[model samples]
Each structure stands twice: as structure tokens, then as C-alpha cells.
Target: MEARLETEVCVIGGGPAGAALALRLARLGHAVCVVERHAFPRSHVGESLTPGVWPLLDALGVVDEVRRGGFLPALESLVCWEEPTGRRVRGRAGEPGLLVDRGRFDALLLGAAASAGVRVLQPAVAQRPERTADGWELPVLHEGRRLVVSARFLADASGRTACLGGRKQMVSARTLALYGYWRGDTPHGPETRVEAGPDGWYWGAHLPDGTFNAMAFVDPELLRERGIGRRTLESFYRELLGRSSLLEAWTAPRLVGSVLACDATCYRDTVPIERDRIKVGEASFSIDPLSSSGVQKALQTALSGAVAVHTLLARPEHAEAALRFYTEDQRSSAEQHAAWAAGYYRDARSYQERPFWKRRALAPAAVAPLEVRPPLSEDGLSHRRWRLASDAALVDTPCIVGDVIELRRAVSHPRLGRPVAYLEGVELAPLVDWLGQVPGEGLTMPQLADSWARRMPFRRSVAIMGWLYRQGLLTEVTADGPR
Candidate 1:
């Protein structure tokens, strides 16, 4: 007999993105169902979580659990990018990133989602979805039974497969990653290692499970030109590692698994969101592996996507605002990461002239040059009176207000990325209006800060003013008269 289920939101792929979205939506009192092709505890890549992920995990109420999950704390990174000599980069005194066993980490998240009241269908395969007048209907095969899942809203978190079809616009040069796990007689240090080579780059890290993963990224054409096939994949991967200074540090390193290859190219979906459907994580965009923030970015998208989906379902009037917010957020993130990766690639002095490096060294044309302001000393800040810059203005922008997306008046300036809707949890529109109401001569730094202090903490107010100054949104009034 066929089984039938209905929900308000149905998410495909129960990885971090899908699970997090289901968890958040369930917490928001929405009926959510998740269809995961693999069961929990499946092996996955992208195990390194940057420090920025801590805040998101805290927001999801999973920080304590993750802390107790027995993952290794990533304290330092050993890099050999610019030269042959390696440099160690340490984390903050008390804050460190994580090196996790992806299988267990992902299963933990999926478990959290189920505990939050989200109906989960594991070990299930979802066929191509059929769009319904209201939302989507998916045919799923599970446990020798055919099941049909109908949902009012659909989310695609299936990673590169992108279960929901859309044309992806390439954001960087095409790349492929070949990797394998290894066992060694001696323990490698806990620090993550990255090295740049003549033709490609290498990354290696010791996981909590006593295994080390070494990966090499190169242009796919190089593999084709070398005539590397399934029988020769292992030898090629081993030969590539032999050329690395960092990854080859283990004593008596022996391969434990077959070599695996995957596309690591960067791209973004042209349409990430719509009225009834959304794409999160790799389904929406894939950034360069150079950042090693793929998991962090996926979680970020899920958190924001939850809000966007909620707004679409509960507040239909703000549909346009919700769509615009998610689309812009995805685009901005993809572009910014692509630019950063290109800049980093350009910094590789070892093989920068090689086709693999040179092709990826140039930033995309869509990326705008970052505007940096000159530093101001305390005396400089105190002596000058300030006013909002003439180019700064209030514009209607979609912002995340509490749980839903709403149109708010935000401060817009050429130096700012997008618009400023809030700073440190305080609304900015009213503050901008107050600044605009100041006299033509403007107010001194102390006066302006004191005025804002009445609305928020004094320190926060001062910090906000400092941000404005750095953004070039505040102009100084001088004896030369507001130059």
C-alpha cells in the first residue's frame, strides 16, 4: 500500500542545511517534513567549521550539545601559501574552531531536527517533485513502500544535485578535488595544514576519529590530459600528495579508502527563491573550498532561509520583500567569497604563473572594490563636528525584523554593502533621521554620541558612531568648512 503524508514545508536532503531549516521551522510552530536520501551517520565532506559557526550554533540552541560531541578543537592552522616556508596562524585565546567527524556531526544535527518535532523520513529517495497549485508533491521510495509527500512550501537542500532544477551561473574557474583518508603510525598535529603547489593546492587535517584526510584541488583538464582513470586514480592522488610539504608529513602513511573526486567549482543559482519554493546551502550556491567555510555558509543560509520561508508562508503581503532579501543575500555572499578566494589565490607566489592559479587569480567583474576609510585618532574624533554625508540617504530595504522579513527604512551609502537596517540589534533608521535633523553646522562627536545614548547603551552608541565613521557615512565639519 502507498503511504501519503502532508506538511506545510517539505525539505529534501537532511544535511546541515536541511536539518537546520527543518528544526527552525518546526520551532516556529510550522509543520515540517524532511526527506533524507541517506540514513543518519552517513559520511560527508566539509568537516571544518570556522569560529563564526559558534554563534549560529548558539542561536540554534545546539552549542552545548556540539561542545559535548567529542570533536577536536581547531587551535591553529599551518599554511604554506605564499612561500615554501610555512606559517602558523592561531585562533583567539579562548575561542577555537572545530574539526569534526562529519558523519557523526551531521547525524547529531538530524537528530536535533527530529527532536524538535519535525517529521523525518530517512533512507528515502525522493524523485523529481511535481509542482502543485499550492506547493509541491514529491514521490518518495522508502522501505519497500512508495510514499507521497505533499507540502505547501518546498525547500531544496540537496547540495550540488540541486533537486529543484535551476541554471547555475559560474562564479569561478572550474575545479575538481581529489581526496582520500589515510592512517599513519605517528600522530599528525591537530592543526589544519594548507599548502600551495606548482599545479594545485593541498589541504590536510586530523579528524577526531584517528584518521587524516588529505585533499588536492586541481583543474579537471589536468586530470584528463594526464589520462587519469579509475585504475590510476589512487596512484595519481598519492603522487600529488608526495609533492606536498605539509600533507606528506605523516610517517608511513597508508591509504585507508579509495580515492574520491568531486567538483569544487564555485557557482550560484540564478533564482534562489520564489513565492513558494526556496533553495538553501549548496543548492543555492557553492563557494570555493579554499575558505573551508562551506559548512558554516550552509548553516548561515539555512538560518536566514528559515526566516525567508516563514515570511512567505505567514506574511504573504511581504512576499516580494522576502524574495528580494534572500536573493540579494545569496548573491552577495557568493560574490564576496569568490572575490576573497581569487585574492587568496593571487597571493600564492609559488605557482601564480601556472594556468590553474592564473585563471582563478582575477576577481569577478561584479565584485565591487571595498571602500576603506582612514583611521582617526581619539583627538581627531573629538575635535571635529560631524554630520551625515550628503551621499547618505534613507532607502526602503528588506530587513530581518525579529522572526519575519519586513520593509524598513535603511541607511544607504556608496561605501556600505547593501543597506544598514540595524546595528548591534538596534534600529538605524531613527538614528539616521535624528542625525539629519541636526543643524547645518552639525554636532560634535560627544554631542552626537550622547544623543544616541538616550536610546541605547552609551558604549553601543559610540560603537555605532565609530562604524558610521569607518563606513564614510559621517562627514567631519572642519575650519575649512565640511570639506
Candidate 2:
């Protein structure tokens, strides 16, 4: 039988992003439908889940059910990505998390959405999304019948496929993961073990069902140059496993299926929302697996995207402003993740000389670091003065920016009660102020230190201006009030 209907929101791709979004929207009193091409219990990757996901699940009212699913508890991680092995706890005390079976984990979330009154269609392919009188219309094939699903708003959670193609997909890191199931004598405890190899990196984990999962991260260009992919992945994976110092202890290792590949490249494929449609999850942005934040980050988008859409629909006058907030949030998140990952590579000093690490570690903060910190020298800031300037790309959210209040800043995630301002995700506010006492050209490091010496140390004030100069948030107006 054919079907035709309209919903307030049509979420494509039944992964965590789409499912969580559907559930949130449905509860908000919106007609929401979720379409999935693959049925449940399918082969899936990205099995390691984050503890931060627990609160998200609780907010969705699925925490107990997921915990009852018999997934293993995870709390610690071991890393050998560089020299000596390092161990770190995921969180302090009661913050234990779970290690999940990807296929089962996703299925659990999807089932929760279905029970929440969300219209769900499985094994359905969505194609040809276009603008309609109400909003966006999409064609779908379900149960051997062609149907049209129209909605006033669209949510594309289709992962990297980006159901809406032709949009720009920019690669921040060129990397891929080749992995397969391996079962044998366990080499280590249940915690995840990550190692950095000469070519790329290695990740191994112990599954709950008495098996193991192994993955290798490497650039495709390296594979082709060395004729690696020419051979079957079985041989290639076996080669990687044999060479690893940690996994080499496993007895009689075996491959469970053909090796699968997933893009590990740090990328921002497209904007989060445009017009009547919003893209969440992997469709909007995909992070590198190094942080193990794939699931946590995706669900965050779902949570925020749902609220953004609700605001857009209920308050028509705030559509542009709502979408703008969502876009900036997503962009800042992706860029920050990329920068931190590079910083980690840099911290792995032993491997900094390796090409695999060199490309990532050497990049400047302005180019990749989370917050650009420029070195301070007398000559560098001695002649420089800075005055605060407004940023067009930012939406000034009112909050305490310094000891004073009522600072209008578009980007901020302040640390403590301390005031900080950011332009285009580059933090600027805490360093410069409207202190008109400095010379018109601006306060040189010596002048700035003298003016605010009571507030902070001399060298500290000097350092802050160096960063401000790199961010272009300061003005060099002459005493005449114009530069």
C-alpha cells in the first residue's frame, strides 16, 4: 500500500542523531517521522561509547533501558600512542560509562523513538528532497510502494552520505579506519587501548561477548603509495596486528568478517541548517575518532538541533537568528575538536618527527590550535597597542565577560566567573578593555602592563595582547581616534 503524509519534522537516517531528534520533537508536540535505510541489528562500527552519553540518554528517558541491555561497564583507558604507556580515568568517581555493541546500541535508541510516538519507516530510501509549499518534500520507497513524505522542516541525520548531496564536504584530516572483528585470548583488560604507529594509529578493544575488535587508522594516499589496498584487507589487517606490541600477545587471532573502512578524516561537510531543512549528526559534521567523541558529539547536535528547529517553527520571526546560532555552535565545535586533536599529536613528542604526526602537530594555533597562544617577547608587543572592536560574525550573548558585567559577545564558553570574549571562535575579550588611558595607537606591552598591573602580572598582560593581535580583535587607532 502507498502512503502520503506531512509532518512537522521529517528526520532522515535513523541513527542516534535522527532517533534522538525524533523523540525530542515528538515530545515537544511536533509531528515527526524518521526514515532509515538499514534495519536494526546490522553490522556497525564505532562501538566505543562515551560516559557523557549517559546524561543525554537520561534526558531522553532511555538510560535505564540501555543500562539493562547488558553492555559492559567502562571507566578507564590506556594509551601507547607515543612512548611510555599512559592510563587515564574517564571521570573521577561515580562517572562510570558503558562499552556498547554498535548495532545493538543504535537499535535500542531507534526502538525508544518508535515507542515515543515517532513515525518510523525502516529499510526505506529517501530521495529527491525539494522545497514545497509547506516546507520540504521528500520521496521515499517503503514496503515496495512509492510514497511522498512532506514536512514543514527537514532533519538530515544520514551520516557522511549527507542525504543532501552537492554541498561542500571539506576535509580537515585525510584519514580512514580499517577494522574487523577478532576473537582470541584477550591481550589486556576491558578498557580501550590505543597505540600510535609509524604510519597512523591502532585501536583495540575487548567486546562484552568474549570477542575483540581491532582497527587501523592510516591515510589512503599512504596505502596506495605502498600498494597496501591492492591486497585483501585480511592480509593487511593481519600484518598490522602482528606488528603491534600490545595485541601481538593474542593467541591464534582470527578475522570474523571482511575488513570494513570508515572515514576517520576530521571534516565539516555542510552547514547545520539552511532554509527549511536542518542537518544533524554526521550529516552536519564528523569528528576524527581519536577523541572517541563520535557518539557524544552526534547526540549533542541532535539535542541542540531539535531545540533550534522548534524555535524556528513556533517563532517564525526568529528563524534566521535561530539558524545562525545553531550554525555557529556546530562550526565552533568542529574547529575546536580539530585543534585539540592536533595538540595531542604535538604532545606525543616522540612521534612529532614522524610524517604521520608532523603534518598535524606543527600547524600554528591560528591555523589549528583550540585557543591560539602566541609567544610573548619585549620586541613583539613593545610597540603594539589594542582597542576592542566589534565582530560582525558573532551574536553578542550577554554574560559576565570580566570582573564587570554586561559584555556583549557572540562566542563564549567562559572558564569560571572570569570574563572571556571570542570572535569567530577565537577568544579575545578578557585581554583588552576600553581603558582610554593608553596612547591612541594602543597600549604597548609596557603601557598595558602599567595600566592593568594591579589586575594582573606584567608578563601575563603582555602575553594576552600577543594573542589579541593574532585574532585581529584589537584596533590600532591613533590618538586622533582613527587609524
Leading candidate by lDDT: 1
Write candidate 1's Cα lDDT for 197-310 as tens digits: 988999999989888889999999998999999999999998998899655557788889799999999999999999989999999999999998999999999999999999
lDDT (C-alpha, whole model) for all candidates? 0.90, 0.72
Clashing pairs in 2: 81-196, 385-442, 385-443, 395-410, 396-409, 401-419
Off by over 4 Å in 2: 84-91, 169-171, 246-249, 362-395, 398-483
In candidate 2, where is summed lDDT lowest over 10 consecutive residues?
410-419
**How well does candidate 2 match the true structure in TM-score terms?**
0.77
Over 153-261, each residue of candidate 2 has an lDDT whose tens digit, in order, gives 9889999888876365554558878888877655556677787877778887777766678888877777777677535666776776666654643676667767887
Candidate 1's TM-score reads 0.96
Enumerate clash totals for all models, in the order shown.
Answer: 0, 6
lDDT of 1 at 153: 94
Off by over 4 Å in 1: 364-376
